[model samples]
Target: MNIVHILKKYPVVILLLLLTACEEDGDKIYLSGLEASEFILTETDILLSKENASKIVLSAAWKNNTLVVSNPDMGAPDVFTAYLQISTQEDFSSNVIETEGTGESKAYTGAELNAIARNLGLVPDVATPVYFRLRGSIGANMESAYSGVKTVYISPYLIDMTVGFILDKDKQQTGLTLASPDADGIYTGFVGATSWYNFFMEEGDGKIWGNLAADGSAFLASSEEGSWNFWYPEPGGCYYTEVNTVRKRWSAIYLPALEVSGDITGEMTFDRPNTRWYYVFNAASAGTATIRFSGQGDEYNYETGDGAPAAGKVTIAFAQENGQLVLTGAAGTISVQVPAAGECTLILDLSDPKNWTCEVTSGSEEPEPVAPEVYVIGIDDGITGGGWNFDNKLYLYNEDNLAYAGVLNVHSLWGYQIGTEKDNWGDVYTQAGGDAYSGTLEFKGQNNLAAPAPGVYLFDVSLKNLTYALTAVGDHVYVNGLDDKWEFNQTLAATSVPGVYSGSITVSGASSYGFKIYLVQNNWNMLFGGSDGKLTYGGADIPDSNSWSAGTYTITVDLVNRTYTIQ
Candidate 1:
């Protein structure tokens, strides 16, 4: 090196010498101020749910999701962003869907960060429940799955849900019932335990329609008639039987839901507008995990077709206690008007730092049981519809209990008049013989001891609460007060006037046989005379019949004419 270059560089040595002599810039010391000892990562937990419906909510929580870096001076976190990652048990692979996309980081403050994590998509509509996961972010930093990944548990829900399932009571709460299919569902009568009744439905045309038959059953309780004669005449003695059938259908069907709730879930309600769906579902990532709700409700007014609007406001009565979100009144007891033709859904903002969030799942389908047909026949058949002719006064007495509630079947049919036509099905009434009106119960006349088959059998006996009166005539006794015509075992005949003036009647059947007699008024009314004065009905007897049965022909006095005649 040159001495000049060395002198230039050595200038600092002379400067240092001068400074050292002055003691001002003698030596320079470097020191650093206190740096933070440690940075701590505070942990936070959250849950999400739906609102409104009876269902609980959708949510899951875990404190391990966040890491604690332990910087004592580090106060509560300022910004929190959550990156949600989701996967199905089928595929553990991690990736974001296309339009379905991945969950971007959602941010929150310290206060709001400690609570719930409901996303807007958690709102329930007509859609079903789907599964997914969530991951969180802090400030501008990203947290890997190992740092913060959470799986969620969700269920079906709605704004306001109530149950109606029972079938035996006037009011339904929970029991067996046929699932309502739709507007076109028919009112079918079937045989149930309660049995012997029918249900009417308001049809589209505004008319009420009824269905009934033998072997069929109903849910409503029924009336019974005492034992009389149950018989068939062809190549037989007494063939006794008594069969029962009843069927019914409900107007509005109801179902319940699965409930879920936690501090982190929100309320769920019905009515949803879909650009396509209420919440979009993500397959690969937690694209859009959605809890859904199902079932139906309507005021006196009802809707039947599409979906409701997303922006419209729902009139929900929110109760702070239990977080009740009712579409009706505050007590949830009020009835409102339902739209004429659409499905509706209400969405709640769950992504915000609300104390709760709710996610709901819709409903699933169930299969219904198959049913059988029913039949009712013979005079006094006790049926509402079916082709029948019961004008013949030949009444039956099957050894079975009889019914006389309100009006009998016979009188109800009188309103139809002779030859009066109606649907192929006849009016309510009873018939008298074999295969008559396709009946479930048939009464067979007995001869020897084999007490008829037990349980319920078809009977040909009917009529109650009335009686037929007649003294006697010279030869034949009249019925219904009309003379000259007679019905002998279903065969028609003409007779001469009796000398006695009692109510004229035709002697039906052979004089030697014991039988039941009635002045049948239409199809439901009947009057008789005997030991009980109530009468020996159907085919069953009082063990003795000589007095009630015909013997030696005799004369009788005339009550109206004050005259007498002998045979």
Candidate 2:
């Protein structure tokens, strides 16, 4: 046949034969020693600043060190895909950032790195190290080994952070400034002269401050009486305060201070029912004398007139003479003289106005210090198992040295206070200084107390001196039930209410499951199980009859009641 005629008639057949041969030869080709070579970073170690971060670029060369062998009649694969991995951990267990494409090199912007660093828990002005590695893949299931890791040092740009306390939520006062965060990013402050203060955080030169909502925005105050109730921050909680750099405004995260109600001193009985009550306060010095009253109802309602007396309620008036205070009111005149210049409290017996008497005390003496027989109530933060609930009454037993002691497991950055009675905000005790580890304690108008870290502690409180000491202790509780597969972490916490522990769990399956509670998750010590609907300490496992059905329930174990209930 002629060449031109044959080519036209069998062109398709010839092409198929050539392709088939190539496929067979290509199938025989194999690559060995496939590995991604160590990356060539632009900078092995970097100290990133805000200014430099914007201008910096993270570039790395990704290379494959694999040996490709092919039949003489075949050729190597045309393209290879490469990937770069960056992480804060050496093992890349978490916080891993990846960049991949079909190229020999990869580049990341400074902004991208900054975001990654933040996710790694890196704070501004703190030097943190990050790791990087490269890998290559040719097909699904065929990937090169990771290359040697490289390190990058980075320090984020910092925004100014400030904290303050607003004494009254109803009225805006020039908030008391708090000490700046130390090297560890911890803020310290003292709160006195106010029953309860709302804490706030601000950024950017500390000029503007606002409230933070759950979604991290400015919280608007309502016009109602308790409109700002929801804005009250929780003590011992860590929150992120959002900032608007352009406007120099900060949406601060609010944290509540530990509140303690100081003791009430002097006993006064009235013989007649009168519409008003009065007390004369004498101060050692006369610098805008301020007198505080602790009784019932709203704090503002208990106060009357700047210098005039009010009928049917409690009232006090002060006039200065030679740096001393002479208080005059409907209850008559009282003189206050003390060695040191300070304020004093006068207990007025108005129940019988005709035969009323005044019991005076200096500022150094707490109105009603904790007494030996007084019931000592604990402060409940969520971590303690009370879930920030104060309804439960957990009283501390009296120990030696006029002290009441209890064991508590504290969560990191959490705060709490002590009180003499249940549901009484007028007699609470708070830390005297910002440092709870070593600080004097005061009652009623004081800041919340917090532990620097999380752990178990032995709280020793003395009502006589209005002081407290916390010593580390070792005591824990655990739950082992069908819901948890008889595992730990189903912990039962002590609530503010004494002798009761509460927790929630999800039970699976339709059948009943019996379990037991223990002092420790893995330990068998102090085992408690249901015995005829009652709790038996160090007893047997709860019988199958008491097994719970499939559902989510809150379990309350009452030691005082010697019973357990699933709700």
Best of the candidates, TM-score:
2
Q: Could you say which candidate leads in lDDT?
A: 2
- Tens-digit lDDT track of model 1 for 421-525: 232234333223223222222223221111121111212223332211221112322232112122432211222322222332233223322333332323222
Q: Per-model C-alpha lDDT, please?
A: 0.24, 0.46
Candidate 2 structure, TM-score to reference: 0.24
Clashes of each: 134, 25
Q: Superpose all Cα atoms of candidate 1 onto the true structure and report the RMSD in Å to 1 decimal.
A: 34.5
